[model samples]
Structure formats: C-alpha cells, structure tokens
Target chain A: MNNSASTSNGSTLHEIVRAEISRRITTGMYKPGDAITSIARLAEEFGVSSITVKRALSDLQSTGLLTSIPGKGIYVKDRFRLVCELDVGMSALGNIRSLGFQPKVQRISVTKERIEDVTLSVFNPPDRLLLCVRKVIYADEVPIVYESSFVPTNMSDKIVDEFGKRFIIDALKRYKVAVKEMSFIIDAAPASQEAQRVFSVPNSYPTLRRLYNLKTSAPTMSIVGIIESPFDRLACSVRPGSGRISKMNKKK
Target chain B: MNNSASTSNGSTLHEIVRAEISRRITTGMYKPGDAITSIARLAEEFGVSSITVKRALSDLQSTGLLTSIPGKGIYVKDRFRLVCELDVGMSALGNIRSLGFQPKVQRISVTKERIEDVTLSVFNPPDRLLLCVRKVIYADEVPIVYESSFVPTNMSDKIVDEFGKRFIIDALKRYKVAVKEMSFIIDAAPASQEAQRVFSVPNSYPTLRRLYNLKTSAPTMSIVGIIESPFDRLACSVRPGSGRISKMNKKK
Candidate 1:
C-alpha cells in the first residue's frame, strides 16, 4: 500500500481521489454514460479506504459531473453545461462568440420608469423617473440572459432607440457617461416567471443574478441595472484561463 | 388628467409608478400586509392608464416585497430580507457583526489532500497534495457560509490546526505568505445536498458560490479556497452602506 489506511486523516483524501477521477472525466478518459470503476476497485487503485472512494464519488455526484445508479454503477453525467469566465468588465457577448455560438440580442421592451430597489448614489436622482430597458440575450437562438437596464430619464431619444441593446455599458459609453467606478452585488435566486419564460426553464430553476452599480462621470446616470441568467447556462470561473466554453450538448 | 395617457410614451411610465409605490412601501408609509390603494385609484391618482398601474404592481410582485391576493387586492409583501453591501476586500464577518449577529466558526475537518479544480499559477505546485480545511460560519447561530480552504501541504502542522479556522487570509498573514494578487470567479447553482444539509433547506434551493485565487510571494501557496452560502440567507447589495443586518423575521 502507498500509505497505511490508519495513517489517513480522511479529511483531504477523498478530495484528491475526487479530483483524479474528475480529471479523467474531463479529459474524456471516462466518457459520458460509461460506468466508472466501482468503489472497491477505485479504493484498490488509489490504495485508500473504501469510505474515501465513496466520499470522492459523492463529491463528483454533487457537482452534476457524475451520477449513481441504484444497482448499476456511477457514470459520467450525460449533460453539457455552458460555463463562461464572466467578470465585471469582460464582454459576455464576446465571450459567447468566442465559445463558437452566434450571439443575438432581442429587445423585449424599453420605457421611462421610476427607479425602485436601487442602490442610491450621489449621482442618481432617487426621486426622478428613469429609463428602463428590458431585453433577452440569445446564444444560438436560445435565451441565456434576461436583463433590465435603468438609466437617467433625460437621455436623448435617439440614443435610447439605439442604446446598448446588448449592454448598458455600451450605452453609457455612447452617451459619454464616463464610468468612474464599477462595483457589483452578486446573488442567486429562483428564476422569476419572466426569467423562466425567457429561458424556457420551469419555475424555480436556479438563476445567477447580478446588480451592477457603475459610478459615472454623470451623477444622474451613475448606476446601470440587473442581469439574470440560468445557473445551468452560465458559469463564472476563478481564472480567466480556466474558463473554456464547453460545447453545450443540449438545450439546458 | 395631469397629462393625457395617450401622450405618454408608455415605456417609462409604469416603471416610474412602480418606483414611487415601491418607495412608499420601503419607507413604511405602507406597512407590510397593508392592502395598498386599488388599481383604479392609483391610476386616477397618477393620471396614467390603469394598465400602467397594473404593470407597476406586477413588477413589485416579483420582488417578494409585495403580494397579490386573488380576490382581495395587491398588498405589501410581508417579508424581511437582510441585504449587505459585499465587496472583494471587505471583511464579511465584520459585516455580519455590523448587522448585529454573532459570528462563529465551527471547524468541520482538516486534512492534507491533492489539489484539483484550482487555478494554476507560477506559485502553486499543481502536482502536490495540499492542506484542506472545511468549516461553517454562523451568524447568530444560523449557518450562513460553508467554506473549504486549500493551502500547500508544507504548511506547519501547527499552522494547519490553527489555520484560519475562520479565514485563510488570517493564516496567510501568520505564515508571512505575502499575497501579491487576488482574483475571483463567481457563480450560482442549485444547492448541493451538503449545502442543503448545512442550511437545512430542501432540494433545489439556489446558492451563491465563489472561488478566490490568490498569488503569493511563494509560488506553491498561490490560491486559497471557495465559499458557498444559501441565497436566501444572504442578499448582496449594490452599495456597502445599503447592506445592513436585517432583523430575522423568521427562520429562512
């Protein structure tokens, strides 16, 4: 044995085993739908306790990277999830394009509305009505993001018609609303009915949501609005290099 | 009419109405469970179309701050959400304290394990096992965060035992691991079973997750770890000042 079972602290053993097995799946060493080695076999191969192998397999199960059958065995999860390296300043649209999918923006609605539920700043006139634009972004014709953008009401009409239908930041740039700072409030919630309808997912599908507050040179137009996307459709990764867009295997 | 409804662009009108009504509810002028003014009355008051008022109410309904009764009327949503202004550098524990909660860390387990699914850096030795620490952080005895930290296995055993039972940053400071840079990857997903067990929620609960990658003076000890929190237990807001510990109305 590489190390005595008694010497194993058991804390990190499963994670290592999990990672080794996860690597195999990621690299196609274990194809989707292929049954993985049994717990006893994995324990023997790694020279770890059976409990450690079970723990490792369980970790992978939680990640939706593998699944266990009642009597058969664990198999690579037969699903593809599209994960993007999304960040505050990075262009998600560009990222979609880089992922080999055609990106499109469909304008749902745009209107002048009063600001509600927003982070107040010195620049934003909390009492005044603002412009709100609602839209959906599509990757290869499948909706991925449902977004609402709020801006100053005084924005020019022509600009509103042509504003960043895809990005509020682009609209800010066009309006010459120089963004001095950009901060984020990130969270997740059950998909709203509107979100579900747009994404074609059922109610309560997990969603990734972000509220971006941009401090602009114009106090009145400092903040943008909110973005919501399906959890299965998007991934925000730690390192930019580590986020390679996976080929979405099916409609998520 | 104050202004002819026909003259209204209708785009921003409903949002303005929505914001005004939302403001009233937030300021407690309309208390929770208070049956708000009828749609016709609100429409007459605003001098816009009744459709606009309905739209406004529908917008508020989605926020969980208001509810619509089938036959009665639209009323203020009777719920409290604790929102915080979270940022990359702010001490979340301190934030919890500022919100009037006692923060405590309960160590689950610590072990030496191999690294996988991590951001590789010049400093991190991808081939070696590392120290892993798992723990839960509580706010007023309510489990809020489940975290796992990874560090070089070469760390002293004393350091591992004491290593940031609450924070990896603290351990890094003690070990004189000079951090050169820090980056983040953020995403959300359906709560894993372990998360459900920790948060005591049912399956399919949404969760917010983040991974932090740190570059330190020592190449082998670059990245730190991950943190997972139940979404309903946390509300990340746009401004730090806006984040205040809310009264726990009931167990979430």
Candidate 2:
C-alpha cells in the first residue's frame, strides 16, 4: 500500500515525513510520553503542507505507535512490544481468562458414538464407543470458538458433567493421563454448518481450523479434537523466545 | 458442515459408520500399512450404501490421515504428525532451502529514502536517510512472500549489492551488529496494491501480514520490516511447544 510509485523521489512525502518524526521518538530523541513537535512546525521543517503531516501523524496514531490526547498534542506511546502469541495448548476457557475476559463454555451436546474415520486415524484408540462432546466457548458472552472432541469411552464418566468447564486435557490429567506431546494441523476452511450456527457467522465464512492430537506419556493418547473460529475474531502469533523454539532451532 | 442436525440418534449414519471403522484403524484393530476391510464389508456392517461408505473414506483421505490404493484396498497411513511450523526467524533463503525448494530473490527495488511512520517508530535513529529494500521471494519459480525492510542509511552501503542474497540481520552481524531478540505482530490485513500485483491476488485479499522488529541486547532494537503473503499461499503456524510456552502458561 506504499505510495512510492507516485512521487518523483520514489517515496511519498507524507510517509517520509512520518518516518522522520517516528525515528526521533524511537531513538529516544522523543522519549515515551514526550510531547512531539507541533504539526505546523514539523510540516514547515519537512517542507510539506500541514495536511500531509497530519495524515502521517494519524497513521501513527491508528497503529497505536503514537497517542493523541483529547486537547493535548500527540505523544509517543509505548514501544512496539510483542503482543503475546496465542497459545494453542491452553484450554478455550483458560485462554479467555488469560486475555482478561470472563469465559463461559456452554455444553451443547454429548453422545457416545463410534469414532469417525478421519479422527480415528490420528490417535491411539480403542475399538469401542467414544464420547463425542460439542460445545461453544464464549468470551464475555460473545461466542468465539466452536470446539468438539472425541475421547475414549472409558474416560467419559469422569468428565461428562463438567465437560464444558475445563480443558479435556486438564480433565484427563486428573486421571493420571499426562499429556506429554501434541500436534496440530492448522488451516483455513469454509466453516461447517454447525460452526456457522454456533458462531452466527455467514455460511462459507473462512474459518481458522485447528485439528490436534493430545498424546500422553503412557504408551497411548487417544483424545483428538477440532477447534474452529472465524478468522477475523482470532489473533494467532508466535515469538522466537517462547515454548519449544530452542528445540526446533537445535533441529535446524 | 455437520449433517448431525438432519440425522437421528444425534449423528449421521454415514458419519457413525466412518467413526466405527476409524476407531478400528486407530486402535490397532487395523494397523498402519494394513489394508482396511473391503468397502462391501464395511457397507454391510454399517448398513449404509456404498456411496455413503465411499464418502466417509474420501473424507479421511483429504485430511492426509489415510490412503487408498487403486483396486488394492484402503490402508492406514501414518498417524497424523505435526506439520513443521514456519520459522519466522529464518531468513527468506534459509526458509526456502528448508522447504526443499530452490529459492530466488528477485529484487524489486532499492532506494535511499525517508522512512515511513509505523516502521520508523519501531527502529533506532536514522540520519534522515534510510535504505528501503523491496523484493519478491520465490519458491520453485512461484512468488510466495513479498518482503520489504528499512534500515539506517549508514548500513545501506554494506548490503546494497548482496541485499537479495542475505538476510539483513546476517549482513549486519557480519559488521558485528548482532541481533539478540526479535518480536512479531502477526495480523490479517487487506492486501495493498503492491501486494495484490505481486501475488496476483484480489484487492482486499486476506493477506497474512507479519511486522517484526529486531533488537540488539542493548535495551533497543532498530530494524523494522514487513513480510506479507496471500493467505492461501502459505501456512503460518506456531507450535505451543516452542519458545516460553511455560511462561505463557504461568501468566494464565
């Protein structure tokens, strides 16, 4: 979206102007919470009209890189710190809590059913019936995640009642089924009809889908599931300093 | 989309049939590399028509969780494993090499110009001039990433010629300017005109945008940049196992 092509210098004047001021703020020439030079002075110094300089300041403000007080002049906001990456390992309820939102898991249905082929192929399993649980997780009363899981029938009685309240892994761990490893296949798919209904999103909405397996330290780990959310509603990220990044770096 | 709503017993017959067979395969009742029961046998046992059974099998195949041989039989594929998360820290050339594809860096433009606001705010002081490097990174002759970076004018001469051949960090590190840590803000944004043209994608395409900053150990990081790709062309993922997932867990 750069306007570099339109200008003779191959750089937009407004953008360049924005950059100069931003550089000052980042380099501690303009410290955090420091008042910036007036727009007119900056415009005159950069040889651009006040309007052009204002657009640049607005851009910075929108990105949260700068802050504008009601009547006061603009000031440098905090440095661009990392927004924590979304943790896929945390339970839906747990994640909502982490974000400072009250969470609720509304259990929609639970049934003992034969495991489906796609899910079955991913886990160490039993040939018997498995408990299939479907629920909608909400953050601050707004439905956000549609989750469904299939677990061994033997573990059904232990979690059926509070199924919506806790992560299946956390619940399973209570039975000494410690999850040692997990894997995820993440993709964007057209939302399923059930997902559409639960999320109140349009049909064929591009949904971020995560299919994962929970593996225990024991020779077996059979719990597998899917979590789907509208792409716009979720924030997914990763940082180099967290989790098993070192292990992956080592392998590389 | 689920057909559960239209079916009795809280599950579709075909899905149930799929689940039963999948359970068998997952439980070692049908081991990996072992041929599954014939379609006719499965159809009979599940009391579903051949088409239903075929649909179930096809669903499994699409997920890369199962395989079928022509006229031979359906056999279990390996258990679903974690697809490698794209390493955001790796250089464009290094990432392409890891993907087993020859990478080519087609330098689009390099100009010494004033920096833009959001970018300038993230980096250190620049003496009014900055080197803006833009390039399309290709994998197997297909453009997969559009990357652009901004650095202090002082380092422009150091990397201008080989800019396409090396990561800016690596080039800087050669001058003993080491990067100690980096952070990312990953978001989905409407594709810009430049991005749309480069990726041959539509306007407002849900472009995957990664904006990052590299910092030296000294209380500050200077280089700021953006990497963008068409959403469909890439799989951007982060495993919770990597990095300080434990710390994130503690915060929760």
Candidate 3:
C-alpha cells in the first residue's frame, strides 16, 4: 500500500476507497445493478478498517448510485444519469440551442377567442381578448412536449401561421414584446391520449407537466402550458446564468 | 348544453373537459389519490363521448396529477406542495425566500488541504491550495442537503472562518468574489452514512446528489456538492410569478 501520505492532504481512508470505487463505476467497469463486494471483504481487500469501508459505501449510496437491502449487500441503482439544467431566459425559443436533441415544432392551431373566466382570472389581462396557440414539440422526431400558449389577442395576426419558425422567442421579439420574467409549476400525472401519441408511452404512462407564465413589463405576455409524458425520462436542469439585457436597454 | 360554437371558441373537446376536471382537482372537489370515475362513467356523466373523456383523463395524467393502472382505474398522484429552483447569480441568495420553508445552514467543518492529483484533477485549481467547508442545510428544520464545498486557497482566509454564515452566496459576495456562472450535474443514488444521519432516512432511501461548479471570470468560487435524500413527495410549479424560481437554479 502506498501508505506515504501523498502530500500534506490527509484524506480519510474512506475517501480514498470511495474515489477508487467511483472511478470503476464511472468507467463502466462496474455496470449498473452490479453488486459491489461485501463491505467486510472490501475492507480486507483495501487493508482499511471496516468502518472506513462502510463510510465509503455510505458516500456512494448518498449519490443515488447504490442501493442496499436489509441483510443483503449493496447493489448499484438502475437508470443513474446526470441531468444538466440550462438557462435560456424566459422565451421558449431561447431553449433550442441548449436542448440535447433537435426539437421540431408543429403548430396545431392559433385562434382568437373571447377570454374565458379561468384564463382571464389567471392572466388578469388588461384587455378581454386572447390568442391561443397550440403546438407539439418533437425531440429526435419523437413528440415530447405538447404546449398551448395563450397570449392577449391584440399581439399579432400572424401568430397561427408562424408555426414553422424554429424558435418562439424570435417571433415574440418581432412583436416588440420581450419576455422579462417567467415562472413554472411542474407536476406528474398520467399521459393523455394525445400525450401517448406524442411521447409513444403506454396509454397508462405517467407524465410530468409544467405551466409557465411569461411576463414582460405588462401584466402578462403569455401563459405557456406543457404536457409531457414519462416525466422521469425527461431530465430537467435549472442553472442560472447571466440575465437578458434589461427591458429598458432593449427599448433603446 | 351551450351549443353556440362561439361558446367553446374552437377549443378542442379535450381542452374543455381537461379544464373542468383540473378545476375540480385544484378546487379541492377531488382529493389527491382519489380515483376519478372511469372513462365510461365520466362520459355518461358529462354527456360526452368516451374518447373525449379519455382525452381529458390523459391530459390530467400527463400533468402528474393523475396515475392509471392497467387493470384498475385512474387515481390522483401525490402532490408536492413546495418546489423551488435555486439560481446561481448576483441575486442567488434570493432563493431562500422562494423556498416554501426557511433554510437553515449548519457548518460542520472547515479545513485546509493540499491539492493532490485527484483533487487537482477534480477542481483544477489555478493555485495549489484548497479550502474545504462542510455543511448541512435544512428545510423547515429538517435536514435535507448535506454539502461539501472546495474553494481555491489563495482567495481568502475568511472563506474558512465564514463557515457559520447563514447564506453562502452572501458570504462569497461579502468577500468580494462575484459568482458569474454555475454548472451542476445532478443524479440519484443511495444515502451515505453521514447522509443518513443528516437526512434521517432509512438505508434504502434514494438521494439526489448534485456537484455544483461556481465560477467567476476565474474559477474563484468553489465546487459545492450536495447529497439530498429522495423527496418522499415532490411538486413543482413553473409559472410567471414574483416569489418563485426554477429548481434548476438552486444547486449552487
């Protein structure tokens, strides 16, 4: 054993063992669901105290990579993958560049309608007119996000016809309305028939859905609601980076 | 029935049905985990076709409000009442206010360490010194986040002593280091022994672990890695609002 304390760094014996095992796991030497050696055996192998081996195993467990059963030894957890959260401002179109898969948008419809009581209550629009646009977003040609966006009616006449555009943020910018702030509510539920068709999940598959409110300096720009099936399969990452230029700067 | 075509305003039969059901669920008419009537029953109840009822149910399921079993009927999924994403930015400390519960930070240890090959490769510090701070953060006084942060040594001696500060973001800012960007890699694993103590979960509990990289013009901040027990209940809301932010923002 290279017992020479590598530098002045006094890494606990447990940390050293943990790092070695983590390397093996990340490198695919230990495949998913593989059983790690018994903690006692591992302790013997590493010439470390059993308490140290136990601590190392404990670290791996906390990272969601390992599972342990009572009386049974440790096993690797299934479907462990890193999720990266990317920040794309508040515009739906801003997310395109960072999406791991190519997203194709198919506009289902865009129409002007008298504001419903529910929507009116939610957006509290300055005016009673509303424009609703429905679209299906496909990732890798598979539909993953089914979205309906409600905008105030006076915004634009070309809203329905502009479905082929790659990003919605650009279109909103063209309308001279900038998305300044946004919020989201996410939940998991079962897939609807349309969601089943889009996500190719079983009819009974559960999904995660998010409702987003896009706001400018005005009351509200749009209410974008998305229906996603198999919510677990879709990884979400939320990282904050530099904010967009302030609305005042954009106006100038 | 209001057969006026304008009454529904081109909204799909599915949308109307979904809206009605969602209203009921959110209004507390239907409780979580309660089974909604079967498709046939709902169709008969609403005087709509079974296909329309199915579509609405599917929409609810896709939203994570409902779950369905192949052999059985559909039921509501558990609702997570509070979900907030922390952001990495100038206003990152604002995240504490967004959380449904107050966050309490407890510093466990502060130590100086020499950068060895493994530590060097992981942190890639410009200097050879590293400051380590270990802490646990609680939500509603329940320990949920156990973290260790490594800062470049030359930054300041205060980085080590400021361990007891309530907010790491504010502490870093006070030290004259601006956090420009943060990167996070999140995954699931089992809880470590230390995690089990802090999070108070059983050995079998799953955990969400994140490795966060806080950077400035130079990577001046630190790598803050946290292992949190798998939430027994998780809920998310992404909407345009003043008080809430995305979960993607909180890792750092």
- Assess the local accuracy of residue B139 in candidate 1 as a C-alpha lDDT between 0 and 100: 84
Residue-level lDDT of model 1, residues A1-102, one tens digit each, is 454343323347876687688778878989988999998998998988998898678656645567677688988855534565434222467667767878
- Cα deviation at B150, candidate 3, in Å, is 2.8
**Per-residue lDDT for B13-63 in model 3, tens only?**
766777777777777878887887788877877778998888678646534
Per-candidate TM equals 0.60, 0.56, 0.45
lDDT of 2 by residue, B1-252 (tens): 232333323266666666666667767888877888888887776667887898677655533335677889988865422223545334646555676767777889888777664533533545477777888877777677787887656654645556655656545544565566666655544455688678654323445566766665432446777777655555455545533323434544
- The per-candidate count of clashes, in order, stands at 14, 15, 34
- List DockQ for all candidates: 0.19, 0.12, 0.12
lDDT of every model, 2 decimals: 0.65, 0.61, 0.54
Candidate 3, A1-252: lDDT as tens digits: 244342223256766777777767777877777888888887887788888888777656644456566598788755412123323322333344354556577877777665453322433444445677767766556565666566666665674356335335445555555467766544443455666556544323445455456676543455444434343334355443345211111110
> Candidate 2, which CAPRI tier?
incorrect
- Among these predictions, the greatest TM-score belongs to 1
Query: On TM-score, who's better, 1 or 3?
Result: 1
Misplaced by over 4 Å in model 1 are A1-90, A115-128, A218-220, A237-252, B1-91, B114-128, B235-252
What TM-score quantifies how close candidate 2 is to the native fold?
Answer: 0.56
lDDT of 3: 0.54
* Higher-ranked by lDDT: 1 or 3: 1
Worst 10-residue stretch by lDDT in candidate 1 chain A?
A: A242-251
